[model samples]
Target: MRSLIVTEFMSLDGVIDSPGGGSYPHAGWTFKDVQMDEAAYDIKGREQQEAGAMLIGRVSYDEFAPVWPTMEEFAEYNAMPKYVVSTTLTDPQWHNTTVLRSLDEVAELKQGEGGPILVHGSATLAQGLAAAGLVDRYHLLVFPLLLGGGRRLFATEVADKQRLTLAEHATYRNGVQLAVYDVLR
Candidate 1:
């Protein structure tokens, strides 16, 4: 079975919204609020290199599909197979893109043959996958600041407790921390 990895740039208070600038009030906080060294982004590069396919929710797919393909840094992601979980999305313009209707399809995808399906900027989708016990791993880049209010990676009300084991961790000079955890089944 393939691994499903959810990666995010989160705040100290567990806020995962608008790290790269969106409609949120604290948009672009990841770069605007923190002035981290280039090394801090090495983890992102590694994720792109290691990921075999990319999976995202409709919102993230809409946000990324327009720009990532043109950017040279996101070439790996642009080239990889992209799956967007959406019930409304009928046509996807991005190359090698597929729209999945539900989390069950995502679960099926995880069982198929492939490398890790890296998920980026899909808070709702991640939460659903986590609650459904479909997520296999998580790569979180936790920033030092806290926004206090925003959508979080983990939901407040969970039906059951999910256990996770810390696989690796690293702290950057700018106080950004990388926490890699494997979801225990």
Candidate 2:
């Protein structure tokens, strides 16, 4: 079975909304205030390469697909397999993408094939994945600031708690802490 890894750029308070731009109030909190160094980039690059495929929720796919494909720096990530969980999204604009219409479809994909499937910036999807008991690892990039009101990374429903072991922890120049945990149930 393919391992499911959840990755997100969250705030100190666990807010994971609109880290991309200023369309929302939570936007620009991490980038405007924080500085990313080469060492941090290298670590992120290495983690990105290790995953066989990327899985995301509809909102995150919409936010990332447009930018990453055109950005030359993220060419490797652009070409990797992408699985999007969406019920209402009729057509996915991004290339090399597949959409999951139902919970059953996601289950099938999780059990299907390939290496670890890394999920990025999809809180709802992550919650669903967690509820389904599919996630194998949790990789979080926690920023210093806290957005007082916004969507959170955690799910409202109580999930079957899985024991997690710390895999790695690193601090970036900008005070962004990277925490990687392996699910040990």
Candidate 3:
């Protein structure tokens, strides 16, 4: 079975809102108010470049499709298989992408043979996968800041039950911290 890895840029307060630009009001609050370096950006860039596939929520897909595809650096992501989990989006403007309408579709995708299935900014999808017991691993970048509001990466209901086993830890010269973990069932 292929490993489903969910990667998130989260705050200490568990806000996974927006880390990119001012597209989200709650976003940038954590990263801007605090002074923190972006650790292992190069390493992340390399990993992104080598990624085989990317899975994202509808909102995230809309936000990323227009920008990342235009970037010269994200060519690998553009060329690779991209899956978007959405109920409302009837047509995907992005090339090399497929929209998944049901949770079962996601499960079937995971059953297929492949490299790591990278999930980025799909909070709802991540939660659903977590609830369905589908997530195999988590690659989290916890920035040092707190945004009081935004779409949370972890569900409030799942706070007590879900436990993670740390498999790897790395910190860069920048304040950013990276931790990889597996969900302890």
Model 1 stretches astray by more than 4 angstroms: none
Candidates in order have lDDT scores of 0.92, 0.80, 0.81
* Model 2 lDDT tens row, 1-185: 88888888888998888876737765876677678566655656876778788888888888887788889877767888888888878778788898888667777877877777888887788887788778888988888886888878786557576688999999977788888999887
Query: Could you tell me how far off, in angstroms, the CA of residue 39 lies in candidate 2 after the best superposition?
Result: 1.8
Cα-based lDDT at residue 53, candidate 1: 95
lDDT by residue for model 3 (99-180), tens: 9998798889988987778899868999988888888888888777767787888898874477789998887665667888
What lDDT score goes with residue 33 in model 1? Answer: 92
Query: Which one wins on TM-score?
Result: 1
lDDT of 1 by residue, 1-185 (tens): 99999999999999999898789999999999998678878888998998889999999999999989999999999999999999999999999999999999999999899789998988899999998889999999999998999999998888889899999999998899999999988
Count of clashing residue pairs in every prediction: 1, 0, 0
User: Lowest-scoring 10 consecutive residues by lDDT in candidate 2?
Assistant: 35-44
